[model samples]
Target: GAGVSQSPSNKVTEKGKDVELRCDPISGHTALYWYRQSLGQGLEFLIYFQGNSAPDKSGLPSDRFSAERTGGSVSTLTIQRTQQEDSAVYLCASSLAYQSTDTQYFGPGTRLTVL
Candidate 1:
């Protein structure tokens, strides 16, 4: 089965611009999550989705950050009016289900750099 995949592994963008990062979860996995880890910091949860239910977007840093999961699989995280603080590794993970203790396998991540 295919593991989670993210494109442009590294992205360099200008401040105040918008960028979209894509994620493809593993096949048959029912849960997907987005997290960001700043330099020397632990992972910060951004959003999570399970099946066709409403996604949990509580962890999004600000209104400028938004995401959507489609067909219970692929998801896209979009940053509107990107800021310097938004430069970090955007990681995507998936588990068999949306359980608090479920182990999540992570992708190499898309590193976004705001210039």
Candidate 2:
């Protein structure tokens, strides 16, 4: 893809089920991030992966949420035991590196709806 892209633009899952969202970043970017946007909470960061370094998951709200980047390219965000509160637009972004000066490119986001 030319820029950051996400899969399954909209997902509707039942409560207690699990869901996985995918993000494909720019060809050579090294930094990837996951964020959640909801009516109750604005844009909230969930995790960050910079190169081969361990991902920074300090922003994750709960243990049920997890994400990973494979081969420094595609990334996946998994939500276990989904709840109504988990309904939100999951966003992904990538930058050249994990530097303050790097500009991040954002994806369209995956809208997850827990029923």
Candidate 3:
């Protein structure tokens, strides 16, 4: 059984450039999540997807951030007109069920550096 994984371990971009971070959740997991961690800060919830239900995106920082889960397996998080403040490590996680009490397995994360 594979654990959650992310791509492009690291990224460097101009301040206004856009970036896409990808994630692959473990098989049989029905709940997926996206989070961000700024340099020394704790993880910040960004979005969540559970089965066929609508995604929960209330945690997205602003309009520049968005994500999508395809086939209920892989997910991508995109940042439009990236800003210096958007520089952080983007993490992904998945759980066996949608319950808030379920344990989430985390990915290593994609680090984005906005210059």
Best by TM-score: 3
Q: Give the winner by lDDT.
A: 3
lDDT of 3 by residue, 1-115 (tens): 7899999899999999989999999999999998999999999999898964545678999999988887878888999999999999999999999997989999999999999
Which of candidates 1 and 2 reaches a greater lDDT? Answer: 2
Clashes of each: 0, 0, 0
Lowest summed-lDDT stretch of 10 residues in model 2?
Answer: 49-58
Order candidates by TM-score, high to low.
3, 2, 1
Every model's TM-score: 0.94, 0.94, 0.95
**Over 4 Å off, model 3:** none
C-alpha lDDT values of all predictions:
0.90, 0.91, 0.91
- For candidate 1, write residues 1-115 as lDDT tens digits: 7788998799999999999999998888899889999999999989888985545667889999988888998889999999999999999999888897878988889999999
Clashing pairs in 2: none
Clashing pairs in 3: none
**Candidate 1, residue 37: lDDT:** 91
Per-residue alpha-carbon lDDT of model 2 for 1-115, expressed as tens digits?
Answer: 5989999899999999999999999889999988899977789988888874545678988999888877988999999999999999999999998887999899999999999
